[model samples]
Target chain A: MGGEFEGVVRPRRMRRSRRGQALVEFAVVLPLFLFCLLGALDAGLWAVQTSAEVSAVEQAAMVASSAGSSPTSETAPDAHAVLTSISGRLRSALFGTTIKSWCTTNASGDCAPDATQRCPTTPAEVQDVDGPRVVVVCVSEADPPACATPPPGQVAPYPPGCEDSPMITVRVVGFVASFVPPGFGPGASGFELPANISATTHTLRFAP
Target chain B: MRRRRRRGDDAQAVLETALVIPILLFLVCNFIAVMVQVTVQEQLNSATALAAQSRFQAPENAIDPSGTRCCGAPGMSLATAGLPTGCRYAAETFYGTMTTYTGLLHWLRATLCTSGGDSGNAAIPPMQPVAYAGSPSNAEVSCDIGSIKPGGTVIPGYVDRALNPPAGLNVVTCSASASLDFADTPLAWGVFWTPTLHAQAEALPPPFRQ
Candidate 1:
C-alpha cells in the first residue's frame, strides 16, 4: 500500500514545493496591489485640490460681480481688488496662482496670460442673447486685458465701468502636485503633472 | 516529518492571509472614506458659494434707489430701524438659498450615504447665525456689515463706501458645518471617527439698487 501511494505522490517534496508556490504567488500580487492602492490615494487628493481651486475661483468671481467695474477707482481698483481678495481667501501655498479678469464683445477671448485676441476697438453695439449690449467679457478664448500690456497709443484692452463691461470673466490658474506618483506606483516620484488645474467663471456685471 | 511539514505549509497560508487581509481592508476602506469626504466637502463649498451669491439677488431693503438711506449716512450711528432692510433680505435670501442648496445635496448624500456623525439618518442642519469671534453685535446675517478689524471683531461698514455700497453689502455672511460620519461607511469598524467639515462665504449684495 505504501509503495503504491509513494509512486502516486511524493508527499515531503510536495509540501515544501507548495510553500514555495505560495511565496511566489504573494510576490506576484504585491506590486499590483500596491500600485492600485497608491493610485487611488493620489487621485483622491487631486479631486480634493481641484474642488478647492474651483471654490476659490467662484468666490473671487462673486466678489468682482458684486463690486462691478468702474472707470473711476474706488478705495481699491475693482478688478485688482477682487483678484487680491481671492488670493487672500486661497491657501498660502497657492500664492503663485494668477487671477485674470477682462471684458469683451463676445466669448471668443482667452483670459489667460500671453493671449493675443483683440479687445473691441470701439464700444460697438454687440448683440446680447438676452438683451441689446455693447460689451461682454470675452473670456471664451479672447485675449484677457489683465494679461496684456498694450502699447502706449493703443486703447486699454479692458475698459472700465459696468456698462463698458457687460460681462466679467474671472480665471484662476495654479498647479497641484500629487501626493503620490503621477501615473503609477509610489516610487515614481520623478513625475510632475504636466498640466495645471484652472477654474474660470463668467458673471454678468450686474452691478450697474 | 512529511505530515508536519504539510501542516506547516497550511499554517503559512493562514498566517499570510491574516497578515495581509486586515492591512488591505484598512487601505481600501480608508480610500472609500476619503473619497466620500472629498465629495461632501466639494458639495458644501458649492452650496456655500451659491448661497452667498443668492444674497445679492435679494430685493434691496431700501426706501431709496441709491441705497444711501439703507444705513444712516457715513459715520451716522447705527440705524434705529432694526437690521437694515437689505441686510434682512440678504439674510433671508442666504438662508433660503442654503436650504435649497442643502436639499440639492441630498442626491450626493444618497449616492454616498455619508453624513456628519451626529446627523445619523437626518440631513445636515441649515445655516446658522454666527457672530464674528469677538463682535456679538455683528451676526452672521446682520445689517451691521463691515471688514474684520484687529481682533476678530467685524467693523460695521464697507471701507470703500465709494461705490455707494450695494444693499446686501451690510456684512451678511453665511456659514455651515457637518461631520463626515465614517460610522456608516465600510470603514466604520476601523475608523472610529471623522472630522467635521465646514464652509463659510461672504458677498456684498448686487450693486443694482432697484
Candidate 2:
C-alpha cells in the first residue's frame, strides 16, 4: 500500500513541477513579445497617418487654388469674407491649415499687387518675407496671355506660345504632428520623427 | 498519474497560445496598414498628373466672360486688343479636374472638394497649386528647347512681342501639393504623436505642337 501511494504522489509532483516551469517561461517571454508587437503596431500606424496627412494637405491646397472654390461664396460675398470662410474651411479639414499669399508687391504693400507688375528679380529683394513667395507664374492670361518668365529656382520648364497673361497663384501649407511615443520611439527625449511632413503647394488661382 | 501529466500539458498550451496570438495579430494589422498607405500615395500622384493634364484641355478660347482683359478673363492677347476667344480659364480647369478626380479610395473621397471645401458638399482639405510654366523667355527658348515642345519648333504667332517673352514659348506645366492625416489607429495608447504625411506631384500639360 505504501508503494502504491508513493507512486501516485510522485507522478503528481512531477506534473506540477513541469507545469510550473512552462508558466515561468511564458511569463518571461510575454513582456518582450508584447513590446515588439506594440512597436511594430506603432510604426505601421505612424506610416498610415503620415500618408493621410499628405493626402489631406494636397486636397486642401488644390481646392483652395481652383476657381470654383476660390474663397468667394454666396454667403461670404466679399474677398476678405471669402478668405475668412476659406480659412475656416481649411482649418476644419486639416489640423492647422494656413494660406500664404504670394503676390507682386502692391502700393499698400502686401495686398494683391498690380496684376501686370513683374515679379521681383531676386527673392532677397522681396521686402516682406511674411508674404508667401512665388515659385512659378503661369501666363494663362497675359495681355498676350502667355507664361511668365521662370523664377530663380523654378523647376518646370516653360512651354511655348504661352505668353505672359493675367494669372493668379495660390499656395497652401499644413502641418502633421509627430507620432513618436515619448520615451519609446525616435523622440523618446522629445526628438521628432525625422521626416518632414509639412506639405506645400503652388497652383494657378482659378478665380478671376 | 497519466491524467495528471496530461492536465499539466494542457495548462502550458493555454499559456503559449495566449502569448503568441496577440503578437501575430499585431504583426498582421501593421502589414495591412502599411499597404493601405502605399496605395493612397500612388492614387495621389495619379490625381495630380491628371489634374495638370486637364488644365491644358481647357478650350484655348475658354475665358471667364467677366474676367478683365489685363489679368483675369479675356487674357491679354497679342492677336487682338482685348481678351480673345479660345483663351483658357485656368482656374476653372484646375477646379474641374480636381473635383472630378475619382482615383482616391471610396471612403476617402466623400465629396468633390469644391469651393475650398467650404461649400458643405464634402469636408476635405484643398489641393494647393505649387508651380506652373507656360510660354518661354527669349533666353529659355534658345537654352531649353526640349523642355518647351520636345521636338516642335517655335511658332511665329506664338511669340508675344509686347511682353517680349523669350523664344521656345508654349507649354503648360503644373505642380500640386497636398497633406493627409491618419485620424484613427489601434496604437493610440502606445503612440504619443500623430503622424502627418505630405506628397507633391508635378506634370507638364499635354504636349501641343505650336
Candidate 3:
C-alpha cells in the first residue's frame, strides 16, 4: 500500500509545499503591489508640479505688483515688459514650457480676442487719454493693445510721450501642465492646471 | 495513512496562505492610504498659502486709490496731456466690499477645493477657528472691512485674507479646519483602527508702522 501511494503522486502535496506556496502568494499580490507603487510615484510627481505652479503664480504676482522703471506717459505705463521678463522665470520654474502674455485696459467687459486670440489694443486716443488703466496679463497666443477702438471721449491712460505714471491695473494668468501622464483617467485628462492671480501695487514711496 | 498525510499537508498550505494574504494586503493598503493622505495635506497647505496671498493682494477696483469714502461714487482723476483729466469713477463699492468681507472665506474655500480635496465629506471636518492674542472670543470673531481702517486705503485691510477679519483698529482673526480618513484592513481577529488628521493656520496684520 505504501509503494502504491508513493507512485500515485498526490498533487495535493505539491500544492502544500512551502516553496510553491510563496510563489503563488507573490503572483497574487504582485499586481496590486505594483499598482500601489506606481500610483504613489505618479502622485508624488503631481505634488511637485502643483508646488511649482503655486510658487510660479506667487512669484509672478510679486513681480507684477512691484514697481518697475518703465518710462510712462501722463497715464500709467504698460508693465508688459516687466510681466514678460518674469514669464521666462515662470516657464523655467514650470519645466521649460512657453509662457504667453495678454494685457487689456478694460476690465468690466471681456478683453477682446479672448484667451486664444491676440489682446486687442486700446485706441490710440485711449492710450493717449488720462484715465485709469486696466492691464490684463495672461499666457495666450496674442499681442497686447490689438488695435481696438476706444469709446468716444475716453483716452488710453498710457500714451506715447506721456509722463510715466505708476498707477495701473495688473491681472496675471499662468498655465501649467497637469501632472498626470497622458492618457490617464478622467480626473487627470484635459486639465491645463491654470492659475489666475491679480495684484495692484504702486511704486514704492521712500520716506523723505 | 499516506493518503491522510497528503490531505493534511494540503490543508496546512491553504491555512498558511489565508493567514498571510490578509496581512500583506493590509500592509500594502495602509501604505497607499498614508501616502494619499500626505499628498492631500501638502496640496491643502499650498492652496491655503496661495489663497491667502491672493487676498492680501487685493484688486485695484476694490481699493479707493483717491482715499474717497466707500459711499462716494467710484472714479479716479486721469492724467491727460500735462493735466489731470477728471473721469467718472465706476461704482466698485461692491467689489471693494466683497474683497474685504469675503476675502478670507473665499480664499479658504477656493484654496481647499481647488487642490482636489472635498470639503463636504464626513471624513473631512470643516475648518475651525483658533484663538490668538486678543479677545477671548477672538477664537471665533469675524470683522468687516468697514470696521478696519476706512475703505480705499490703496492697501487692502487684511494681510492674509483667509483669517476672517476684513479690517479693524483691532486685529482680525481667522480659523480653518480639515479632516481625512485613513484606509483600513481586516485583521486575524478584528479590524485595525482608522485615523483622522487635521490642520489649522492663523495670520495677524503687521502693526501699523509709524
- What lDDT tens digits, residue by residue, belong to model 3 across residues A67-141? 232233122223355455555545554553344445453564334433443322331222233211222344222
What class would a CAPRI assessor give candidate 1's docking?
Answer: incorrect
Tens digits of per-residue lDDT, candidate 2, A98-202, equal 333334435654435244644333322332343222122111112323466767775323333354322232222222223334455443223222212222222
lDDT of 2 by residue, B1-210 (tens): 667767877787777779777766666554654555464454445344434433333333331122212122223232222322222233333333233112222222211111110111212232232112222111010000012233453322122212222322233333333433333555332233322333333334322311
Indicate whether candidate 1 or candidate 3 has the larger TM-score: 1
lDDT of each: 0.41, 0.35, 0.34
For candidate 2, what is the DockQ? 0.02
Best by DockQ, which number?
3
Worst 10 residues of 3 chain A by lDDT: A199-208
**TM-score of candidate 3 versus the correct structure, residues matched by position:** 0.40
The C-alpha stretches of model 3 lying farther than 4 A from their native spots are A1-23, A61-208, B1-33, B50-175, B181-210
lDDT score of residue B10 within candidate 3: 74
Global local distance difference test of model 3: 0.34
- lDDT accuracy of residue A117 in candidate 3: 39
lDDT ranking, high to low: 1, 2, 3
Chain B TM for prediction 1: 0.54
Best by TM-score: 1
